[model samples]
Target: EAGVVQSPRYKIIEKKQPVAFWCNPISGHNTLYWYLQNLGQGPELLIRYENEEAVDDSQLPKDRFSAERLKGVDSTLKIQPAELGDSAVYLCASSLDAVASGYNEQFFGPGTRLTVL
Candidate 1:
């Protein structure tokens, strides 16, 4: 009955440092998503997971970013060798189905704000 949960609501690190974010989706949700939002821009999908399989991750930066949703529940997103441009809010959302529609509402966590100096 709980909503999505994320850790370390805020994080600050220097460039080249590594940062990690965690998310726990709502119970019974079958789809999960990770999104990146830059200031004044809408959230863009970084990765999407259906159950334990990663269905989409084209927007994710493979060079320094990695994510995993294990056992179809908890998920983690990591950005290594963080860059100054990586400063933004990382949001985690979950839905009851993969095929998003007007009837399916996605619940979002407060999100993790990462600052790279």
Candidate 2:
């Protein structure tokens, strides 16, 4: 079966440009994750969702970055006025209900790499 799918695998934009990334998670997976991976660093959790509710988003940059999983299916992350420091890989991941599944095995998409010039 195919895993999570992300669009626009690569994007290049000048600084201060707005960018958005799309993700479609696996069927029946109710947990969604958004992560940011900087060069030479591990992925950092940007936000997390259970069904359509954002369960964890403390790490998300409220000023310029926002995300939504409207119907608990597809998700979108947007970064307005993107900065040079925002150049990184945005990853989408999904997993079955962590509480019910008893494990946190997440399937990750290829990710969208954004470059700010």
Candidate 3:
């Protein structure tokens, strides 16, 4: 079933520029995730957080990428000084309390595609 989705499905920017993406998860869902998908590859988790607390962000590129969940609701992901390698589809997902719900289904957004020039 189709549900969550991102805005400005496509974006193009010059190298070294910055970009941001927004996500609004399903109501009542307490867990949110951000992922990056390269061409011909599966999406990889960049960050996952519960409420406003980040629980997993080891895969995120701290040097250039950052994410935040505001008031445990809407979330945003950003990239600064984007490079050629940063071009990819950024996906957002949400689920029930991940730690307590044990394997809850994740609802994913269509994703925002970024192209660096």
Candidate 1 per-residue lDDT over residues 1-117, each given as its tens digit: 788999989999999999999999999999999999999999999999999888999999999999988799999999999999999999999998867665578899999999999
TM-score of each: 0.94, 0.97, 0.95
Model 2 lowest lDDT segment of ten: 96-105
Superior by TM-score: candidate 2 or candidate 3: 2
Best by lDDT: 2
The lDDT of each candidate is 0.94, 0.96, 0.92
lDDT of 2 by residue, 12-59 (tens): 999999999999999999999999999999999999999999999999
lDDT of 3 by residue, 5-79 (tens): 577699999999999999888888899999999998999999998999999999999999999997998899999
RMSD of model 3, in Å? 1.5
Model 1: residue 64 alpha-carbon error in angstroms: 0.6
Lowest-scoring 10 consecutive residues by lDDT in candidate 3? 1-10
Clashing pairs in model 3, backbone N/Cα/C closer than 3 A: none
Rank order by TM-score, top first?
2, 3, 1
Better of 1 and 2 by TM-score: 2
